[model samples]
Target: MPRRIVIVGHGMVGARFVEEVRRHDPAGERASLTVFGAESHPAYNRVLLSTVVAGGLTAASIGLHDPDWATRRRVTLRTGVAVTAIDRPARRVLLADGTSEPYDELVLATGSRAWVPPTDGLLAEDGALADGVATFRDLDDCARILELGRPGGRVAVLGGGLLGLEAARGLVGRGVRVTVLHPHPHLMERQLDPGASGVLAAALGKLGVDVRLNVMAKRWTPELGLECDDGTTLSVDAVVVSAGVRPETDLADDAGIAVDRGILVDDRMGTSDDRVHAIGDCARHPGTVSGLVQPGFEQAEVLAGLLTGADPAARYLGTPLVTRLKARDIDLAAVGDPLVEPGAEWADASVEVLRFEDPFRGRYAKIVLRHDRLVGAIMLGVPDAAASVIQLFDSGAPVPSDRLALLLGRALPGEATSAGGPVGSPALLPSGALICRCNTVSKGALLTAWRAGATDVAALSKVTRAGTGCGSCQSAVSGICDWLAAAEPAELGEGAA
Candidate 1:
């Protein structure tokens, strides 16, 4: 009697959608779920692949789903089974194994695939990855890089974006000499300004990473290293390509779903057909950007609410993106439009740009405010300021009058200050403040889990799904746990008295 929901592509977003739906329909009174994943392994956090390559995390550590998770929820999860086609007339999906399954509604979370350039020797004649070259995208790529990248070996990473830089840093941690080739002159040009990029480059240089800006890989081979556009060759044992990713939209396109660069969806994550819905990297809604897990997770929550009738009026306006780089020895977080050109529109208008740069110390902080509200910020080498800025941005709180003090990690006028300055504390954060952007977990949710006897970080993670994605919020989650532990004894002492 329950509506059957068939989901394609069991990546992070898809797995999350399953969890959301099950949470709403715990008794299976509304919907029965079936998920088809093309990958052989269970869903894992793609953002933590760099940490796995760096030997900090194992393949199993970053997994999102537990054993028998689907079984306990009465969901059918089929891994290693690709959905070949969608038969709209019959409302059934064809599988690679020549089987078919009928559905009342369908969801696509195929996510995206790494896009490697057409450089010579990067791909074989059959379109497979050639020897000594890999794209840093998924768990398989991490395994390949780990096997190829030996200590004291040489590695060439093509691309200077976030993933590329992370890959380069991870290889460096493995004692491999790394050279990053980027077409853009600055690192993370999309998220960082040129000034911040320079500071980051200096930090990377100190960490023993060779950064080659404004360069492109013209060709590559196993015998010879990457050949640059400028007629230069560098010898390397392995080549890791972090060029970028393209959404996997072939299934949606072939099935008559509206497709642009990604599958187009509405506010409720519904596709052209009423019976079909899409979310995650494959879903392109207004104001939604790909490659960030937060938007996809938000879309999943919205769609689940709509599907389960838990909140029929629920709508996804869009996610406020917070970008964090998880590379070792580097701390950087960028939110909104931090990169604004001088003399450009909004430069002299309501926008106020405050910047502090210490190039020698490899530190930079930039905050963009509009009408005295935090809109965008870039913080590097300033963890305390980064936390406060992120809180202000997430909460849409008013900026204090002492803007410079906030940028310099000093306490505001009414705030309590420590000897080292006022570091943002979990206790100080608003309950609604986001603790996990990827999963949209809030501080209140974490506290609720803590009150339910999930005292440690690991237990809290399982209960509230905090500190799971990208693992950037682990420090924040730990801070909350520490605060709770310290507060519990005080409450117990007061009760005894």
Candidate 2:
């Protein structure tokens, strides 16, 4: 008999695990699988929630799984069902409805929940879930915020991290006056350096967002805005908290599983109990919790290899601190560290320090280097350059011989390709390369759906949810429409034109 696997928490990680399992073991009689999710729908993309709030995407475009695909694979997907507890004694999981199911091996992909730090009056009179106070962790949260947001809404996003900034941008696109409360010295302190942060802060300020740093929310008055540590209050419509996250580990701990910051697992993602495994945001491998899709997919592939009677030589190292913020009209990506101490012996840069700051153009870029090695850099405007930089980083290409050629309106001689990209040209188009760091959809995927008969942006919106949440990618999606039309002019008709 094939091993029976039960996975809890159907977010990106859980859903991806199932996909890998089916792909590795296409003959399902070899391995039976079932996934239990607390949400109402099969895993949709959480990264695109902000876009949905901005009216650019619908529900379908962000969905990652298909019901018919699951049925055809004989994968049982149970949504709207919560697993209350895991009865390890019986090796079965107890559901909220009191039914119990047995599993030869259990995988806890419970994922993390947004950390809502304790604050004052964030509750109703009886301490119920507050109306004006919600989180942006899932699709439901985005839907609630959209329902509450109106023509003239006032919103305050707690936390200046990626999600917090994305939420603020979405609310702003909805015509809501938005304020971002961050406890750090600068926004995205983890990704961008001080110089880059300054550029980003200035850019956000120009967009009318109130960027307050080194400020912590001391309390939340649902009627008012957030009360900061300095007694200054930010008055707004709703308090959307993106304060960070704590891994969901109650079940793992209760089962006598070892857990530190998260459920402790080895490189193989096998927890203390050999019979129990974990992946995604919840599994704290010796390496950091990447919190990105790529690492989680890596974990799934490794486990899938082990389950399929393969040697399973794969081991996850860790994900670089990469930030691709999907904010309104912004394209920013940073890998490794953007800010290093002054006089640090960094990689060589063949290009001179390219500086472009035009308040009129709303663009700023600071590319740092040693000879031609990309150590760290930041981009304020000129999003088209992001892909080129990523390509350089990936290929480990040496910088151009002429240092100044890296500056504005300059491309290394003979480096320009047919796509008009630099010599290495990430070859990934800005439209398809996931300019919107939020949803993470490639331009190719969007075009595929369009050519497959999805019509109009709205219809495309329903299929891809590209511009739904943040509106930053709206223009990018429009560009994709043009690109698609140019490729197949006859099919798109006036819609593409």
Best by lDDT: 1
TM-score per candidate, chains pooled: 0.95, 0.80
Best by TM-score: 1
- Cα RMSD to native, each candidate? 3.0, 6.0
Tens-digit lDDT track of model 1 for 353-407 = 8999998998999999888888899999987788778777777889888989889
Clashes of each: 0, 27
lDDT of each: 0.85, 0.70
What TM-score, to 2 decimals, does candidate 1 have? 0.95
lDDT for model 2: 0.70
In angstroms, the error of model 2 at 230 is 2.8
> Which residue window of length 10 is worst by lDDT in model 1?
414-423
Candidate 2 lDDT tens digits, 380-473: 6655455455545544577555544453424433221211122222123433345333334555567667877875666665576565433445
Error of 2 at 200 (Å): 1.8
